[model samples]
Target chain A: MRVALFITCLADQFFAESGVHAVKLLRSLGVEVEFPARQTCCGQPAYNAGYWNEARSMAEHTLDVFQDAEYVVLPSGSCTTMLRAFYPELFRERSSKFKQAEDLAGRTFELAEFIVKVLGVTKLGDGLRGRKVAYHHGCHALRELGIKQEPLALLANAGAELVDWPASQECCGFGGLFSVKLPEVSLSMADQKISTLPRADYLTSALAGCLLHLSGRMQNHRVGLETTSPYGLSEVRPLASLLWQAVEGAA
Target chain B: MKASPNNYPEEAALVIREHPEVRASVTGATLNFDQNRRKAYSEIDTEAWRVWAEAVKNHLLTHLDGYLRQAEASLVANGVQVHWAEDAEAAQQILARLVRENQVRTVVKAKSMLSEELGVNPLLESLGARVFETDLGEYIIQLENEPPSHIVGPAIHKNLEEIRQVFHRHFGTALNETPEALAAVARKRLRDAFLRAEMGISGANFLAADTGTIALIENEGNIRLSTSTPRIHVALVGIEKLVPRFSDLAVFLSLTARAATGQRLGTFVSLIQGPRKPGEHDGPEQVHVILVDNGRTSVLADPEAWETLRCVRCGACLNACPVYRQTGGHAYGYVYSGPIGAVLAPGLLGLEAAKALPYASSLCGACFEACPVRIPIPKLLLAWRSRAVEQGMTPRFEAAAIRAYAFTMTHPLLYRLAARFIRYLPDQVLDNRVVPVVKAWTEGRAGLKPSPKSFRELWESGEAQ
Candidate 1:
């Protein structure tokens, strides 16, 4: 199936490699992925800050850019939720725009949900077998999209050891504007979430926004472990790429 | 008391820095309440019950004036004096007038957040009447001369040792009095307050219109004494507390008890219909019911915020909120706190008095999940935020930045150009220094840096498909 990649502005601008990995993973699984060049944002930041006029305009732009796509996938659950859940809300009083939003929202999915549910692929066997992975359940994905088991199911199928962290469902406090507005409380919440990290080798999340806040804070403290989007996890690579020695030996 | 929620940053910082125990206590208490609330509702359809509760409240609110009139007529017919208060000052004035008219030298109070909202105790004391709190937690805080940090457990922030000190200092009890000892001391001390007081003041948990009854739910029997022992009993109730029928109490009573303390029923559920009849010997001689608006009518006028008035004040949302778990109630610097405060304070106190409150939450939504009436607290918070922005309460720079960001997002050419421009900036310039708008964000975390290549550049490179 052909898909349009809704790489969130954060993932596109700061973590483009993850976007590349997402494309590679989708292709390896035999689904074609397209990036809509004109797509700017789903307007989450604006919507979150109560800038409805700006947010609606951004949504209108997004809907226009992705109008032709049969399916749209984004790595960030929050962005996906923003489009899928809030677009209709933004256009509530306007029937024509609301209908358009509803249509586009139906076609949108978070990357992991799209991969597992739409692509119908759970395991990418032996790519990064035996890596101890801890999943950071993004608040929107966990609570809004109800995306609890999909990422873990896919990771386990990919031959990774999944460990659970205490208060895993609690927010990492990177609540868009909330991170900047109430920085002290935001940092305190992040610290509480971070305290559970030592047990896992790498933290995985479906959304890159949480990773950005978490990794940024993790870096501030000089923590040893790194965070990755699920697509970038080594487990999804082909066997040849997974075994570095095999690629080198063949060369 | 501060007249504005603008001090939230400094206040939140202080609460976080000074009160580590507040976090631990609030988290523990809320988690326990959540767990128990779930278990307590195991036998029943909790969601369906919530729907019914919501419908009941909505129906009452829809015909609020009718129900209130019916209630007043019923109350007056039962020989209970009814007073209407348009605002907090008016409510206080009514109570002050009652105290003056009765020549009440001493008063005993049950735990009533409405009274807290009215600032009644201090007002009464200043009016030359001695007021003593009869609720155990309220008594503890009253002795310590501090506002309650938690609604139901007013002294949840205080440990047993702290209570012991307060009791020892005030009642001349032992320094290390146990919980039981502290309770005994409170019981003994308040016994006289209950008997000597010429009047009693209470906040009703629910005002049942069909029965013309005021229901008081308490674990302690203090409410019984406060409303019964004194010759004059006055109940201060928010107009939003009206329920249509006596039978409606079953759902509300269960939801309230479980949502609050996880009990299937509070130890005492006193429903007072009116003043005692001539043959009655043990109850109060006069009953006064003050139906308080105190900004509730304004809250009701905002359709988006009207559901906030549906809250039973069970403190469930506060207990479930992560922000409240961290900052406690005092940080909100108002009568209400947590998700309810975020929603209600803004609507009641206006954007200026509560603009910072709506921003205080991370929008975690645990409170919504925990609300008994299923008030969409997070959604209400967003509504308040929108109102705040409309009123220009946000910082000018922040508003400009958001508008600029929105403009860029809506304009593909500008967004693309900005994206390309940002990519060429050095990591140090982008990630090391805090920018003016996001300075608070980068304070305790690393700043964000743009990727070397945008995703559009990658997709166009045709390396994947």
Candidate 2:
């Protein structure tokens, strides 16, 4: 099976390993993953800020960049939501591109959903055996796309011990512009999520913004970011990167 | 504290920074309500009930004019005096006229957010009438002279200690601890008000056109006494509160309390058809139903926003919203706050008046889940945001920044070039917080640092294969 990798702007620019490992994982699964180089941001920031015309301009470019690909996958659920859930609404007035947006939306999938459902490869490796993992359920992925079991299934199959996190469904308050718009409230919300988290070996999420907001705050603006439970995990990375590490570590 | 929708970000920040106590109470109260709602929903098929309720409300909203007409005819047929108010002033004018005609001296009000929205207390007081709030929470806030800090729980921000203090000052009582003691004091005070009050006022939860019935669900018996004890019963209802038939109350009645305060049903579900008939021993002598529009029709005109009218004012959204949990209702600078207010404010008040409200939420989608009617609140927020942008109500600087982003995104080479530069940014710039967004983000969290290599750069070097 072949798929197009839409390396979201955040992952590509800030957390490149997620995209790198996304490709690595897909290739090891015997799936041909193509990185469409001309792709840029998913126009989510603009779309979310209510700048639809600007969003459409970027979305049109993205649509053209991956026009020939069979399926589109992304490491970020938030951007994936922008593509699959909102692009159609953005293009509703442009009858020609509306169908294209809907078409793209149909073939688009988040990394875990793509791996478990589309690729039918649930168990990547047992490298994560005995490793307690606390997965952050990004709001867009869990709600907009209805992705709950797919990522957890993949993590559990990799021999990761999935902990029961109370604030798993809570938002990390990295709501694109909301973080900057209401910084204090955003921090308080992150504090709420962090203070309630269960101790684990790693905290991961499909949406990179959650990681950016959460991992940043966890470290108190420094480097040695540990699990929110104080004496626990010492790493924060995207779900795709963690999955790739699980498989490659075994290899 | 005075706040306005135009300055939401600053107001929210002030609350978060200075008012730790407010944050604690807001968080505690809302979280408790959310827990109750979730537990209540878990016992039944929440999905089916929500879908059914949403469909029913959608029908009511779409055929609102017809339903209003039918309800008016039925209410009139039942010997009810029905009046129409096009705006707040008109509603206040109707009240003013009624008070004059009946020589209304003291008016007792059950908890009505709509009445608060219309600013009726001051209006009645200005017309030489003494107004009393009978609902416990409302009575406390009335004494405090504050707008409701919550949708359902008006005094939710006040701790028991604060309430006791308010009661101690007003009723000259000892600092009360027992709920029953405080309630007894309120009851004694309201009993005298009820005896002397010439008019009773309320807001309806649902109005059934078929039977010309007004349905209200309240845990406190205050609404009961307010509507029944006075000589004149006047209910100021929003035009959106219409149901097709009397039996349809079963669905709303089932979900309203469960969603609001998480009860199987409120203690008292008053279904008043009209004024007391001649044979009726103890009920109001005269009943008046004033259908108030007040920009609801303006909301109805919008194809997408007509769904805002589907709200049942359950306050479930307020309890579930994360932002509301942080800042409480006062920061929204509107009668309604949280997700419904975020959506409803811009529609009711013009966009310019409430420009900042649409952006108050993080679009977490909790409010939509909590809503019994399943109003697509996030979608409405986006719609309002889009309209705001289209009208150029958002900041010009942000608009320019987004345009620049869109430009660079469409032109990938510029994006790649910017990517290369961002990775190599000196620690000083990141630490110094040169950019405003970076400044905002790093206020509490760590500074952002881009990866050394862009994904496209790695892909171009043939590293993936």
Candidate 3:
């Protein structure tokens, strides 16, 4: 199947390697992936900040850019949620874009979702064989899209030891503008989620924003993060890169 | 006077920096409540019950005016005097009139958040009546003259040491008194107030329209004494509390008890129709039910936010919220706090008083999950946020920046230009020391930096191929 990769602005700008890995992973699995060069954002940051006019403008732009794609996939669950769930709501008052929004939503999928559900591929060559991994579920992916078991099933079957952090379902507090607006509270939220995390080889998540918030805070807490008893954890990676490594069995 | 929620940033910062104990207490208490609530929900067909409850509340709200009139007629026919309050001041005036008419020198009260909203205690005290808070948690905060921090667990923000200190100052109780000892002391002290008080006040958990019945669910039996022992009893109910039929109590009460405190049933569930009959000698001589509006009608008038009326004030959303756990209730500077408060404060208090509240959450969607009535709280929060923006309540700089970002996103050329321009900026300009937003990020995380190459550039380079 041919697909258009709606590379979210965050993944495109700050974490481009993850997007590259995502493209390779899709191609290796036999699905052709095309990068939509004009796609800027799914309007999440603006929408989240209550700038609907601006968000709608950006969303309208995104609609025009990906109107003809068979399927549009993004590496970030948050942006995918914006495209899939909120776009229709955003366009509901306008009948013209409303149908367009629904059609776009129908074709949009987060990367992991497309792999496990559409590709029907759970195990990936034991690439992560024996590695301990703790996957953080971004709030939008877990709650908005109901994506809980897909990532876990893929990782476990790929020979990774999944460490179940109790607050896996909890938010990492990178709520777009919420991270910068209430930095202290945002930092505190990240602390609460990871303070008791179990020992792991890696901490990964489906969304780049969550990784940025948690990794940023983890950098500050380097002294105290793994200081004592449990919770000996290491560097943070986006889930796409991790999935790609697992599938390709790349060291 | 309402606090400016614009001060939320300073208040939240102060709590995070100076009030570590408050954060600790709130987090512990809320986590405990959340664990029990999740466990309770897991034991039942929670999804089915939530859908049923949502349908019932929606039906009531959709037909609210009719049900409210029906409730008033049924209440008056049941020999209970009914009063309507259009706002807080009106509600306070009604309470003042009642207290003055009855010459109520003392009052024993159940824990009523609505009473707190209307400042019932201070108003009664001003009119020469001594009001006693009989709920142990409410009594603690009452002695300290502080607003309740949580709807259900009012003293959740205070640790035991602070409570002990408050007691030592007022009751000369030993500073080292255990929790059980302190409770016994409060019970012993409140028993006198219940006997001598001429008036009692409570908040209705649910008012049944068909039977004109007031249903109150509480783990403490103080509600029973407050309603029965006093000659005058008054129930201040928000208009949203009405349920259609008496049997509807089965679904609501169960959901309320389980969600609020994880109890199969509260220790006492009082269903009072009216004053005592000629054959009956135990109930109150006069029963008053005041249906207070206080911005509720405006909320009801709202097309998007009226769904918040479905809330039972079970406080599950507060317990499940990460931001509420971090900053505590005082940070919001309002009567309510947490996820529900984020929406309700903006709706009830207006955008100016509560503009910052809606932005306080991470929009994690946990509150939506924890809601028993299935209120889509995050969606409502976004609705309020958009309204706030329309009202020009948000910051000017942020507004301009977001609009510019949107402008860039909408124009492919501008986005590419801006993207390329930012990529070439020196590391010093991108460092936390240089930018305020980055400075905030560096407070708990690493500094922000752009990748060396954009995704479009990677695609152009044929790196993946």
Best by TM-score: 3
Candidate lDDT (C-alpha), each? 0.81, 0.88, 0.89
Q: Give the TM-score of candidate 1.
A: 0.92
Error of 1 at B275 (Å): 2.2
> What is candidate 2's CA lDDT for residue A111?
91
What pairs collide in candidate 1? A13-B451, A128-A235
Task: Please provide, for model 2 over B1-465, each residue's C-alpha lDDT reduced to its tens digit, 9 standing for 90 to 100.
Answer: 457777778788888778877878988898899999999888879999999988988888888889999999999999899999999999988989999999999999999999989999999989889999999999999998899988899999888888888888987778855778988999898999999999999999999998999999998898999999999999999999999989899879979999998888899999998998988898998999999999999999989888999899999999989888888888889899999998899899988999898888788888888999999999999999999999998889999999888999999899988888876778767755678878887777777777777778888887656
**TM-score for chain A as predicted in candidate 3:** 0.95
Which has the greatest DockQ? 3
Pairs of residues at least 3 apart in sequence or in different chains that clash in candidate 2: A221-B446
Candidate 1 vs 2: which has more TM-score: 2
| Residue A111 of model 1, lDDT score | 76
Summarize candidate 1's per-residue lDDT along B244-311 as a digit string, tens digits: 99999988998888888778899999999899898877899999999999898888999799989899
Kept native contacts, as fractions per model, are 0.68, 0.76, 0.81
Candidate 2 chain A weakest lDDT stretch, 10 residues: A221-230
Q: Provide the TM-score for each candidate, comma-separated.
A: 0.92, 0.97, 0.97
